[model samples]
Target: MERSTGVQAYYAESAERLGEVYESVSFEDVHGALLDLLPEAPARVLDVGAGTGRDATALAGRGYTVDAVEPVAELRRVAERLHPGSGVTWRPGALPEIPGVRGPYDVVLLSAVWMHLPPEERPGAMRRLAGLLAPGGLLLITLRRGEPPVDRRMFDIPPEEVADQGAAAGLRLLRTVAEGADRLGRDAVRWHAVVLQLG
Candidate 1:
């Protein structure tokens, strides 16, 4: 929960709009590259920045136990309302220091949320993410690349940088989908999925 105040406010005020926009894309479509890498059902999964519970709900439907962490209150409300009885627990939290969450999850997912962490915080954040994983657990991180929006804070983090940081945190690089077209059809935006594993 160490993100800046402005980012928090932005998500809070835009939660409704964001919920609609985020849910427009199906989980399979958004995460197809790494879908096969997900652990089987009954495994514990943590979805950070789980806006509107799109992925969390979908994962729950697949029979996995999911804990969804969202920083904005409005988004959590929207998520619960949109997917009632989804079997996914929703909580307020942020990166580098996720509070109130019991970890050692089989899978940890961060979709389109890592860019907000300032460069200096990435190493620490990577370590924290690593610590949250169980032995041989998977850490799936989706990076949004290209120019950032004018209104919100973002960084164009390279995949190599993340891989290096993960390695420094004792994670082994497992897979890297170099780039994919933006599902939202934004020409300026692309995505990269980096999967790491703890020994």
Candidate 2:
């Protein structure tokens, strides 16, 4: 997919910022959500657009085999360095073109990554994402529910839109959760976490 140069630059900057914030993020919600879908036993997982290895590392620490794919070279390097001996494989590439990672993944995670794609490219991307899932495997995605900077086209698509797109991509929506606004509620981003199954 062709992105405007301005959008590319905006992502580059955002990737750097996200790398810095990865460690500080509260993963409890995400972990709880994943556990509700996945079996207790460790499973092979793929972290799509993994920014700085937070989720991948956490999963690996729990004995799950993890392969993390990140497009930003700098962020990939940072993740690799931070998680030395973490047993998580870090690949530098984007979604739909994850290098050296074979899937049939028990879980494919697209956290905070869907909104980065140009709105027009999302369905195709989701289709490819669905293809990576093992039969009955979960495709977990969390989209930020608001407009991003104008230079970049961040998809602020609603929950219904996401469900519709999931159907178009041959995915079945198993669960949808809308998080409450954060403390202060002003400019607080609400997140839509959807658990999808590829039929």
Would you give me the overall lDDT of model 2?
A: 0.74
**Candidate 1 overall Cα lDDT vs. reference?**
0.90
Candidate 2: stretches off by over 4 Å: 1-8, 14-17, 29-31, 182-186
Provide the lDDT at 18 for model 2.
56
lDDT of 2 by residue, 140-164 (tens): 8887786565676576767777788
Residue-level lDDT of model 1, residues 1-199, one tens digit each, is 2478888888889999988899999999989889898888889999998888999999999999999999888889999999999999999998878877888899999998888899888898899899899999999999999999877788898888889999999999999996678999999899999999999
* Candidate 1 TM-score, true structure as reference: 0.97
The lDDT values for all models are 0.90, 0.74
Using all chains and alpha carbons, the TM-scores for the candidates as numbered come to 0.97, 0.86
Q: Model 2: C-alpha RMSD to truth? A: 2.7
> Candidate 1: which stretches are off by over 4 Å?
none
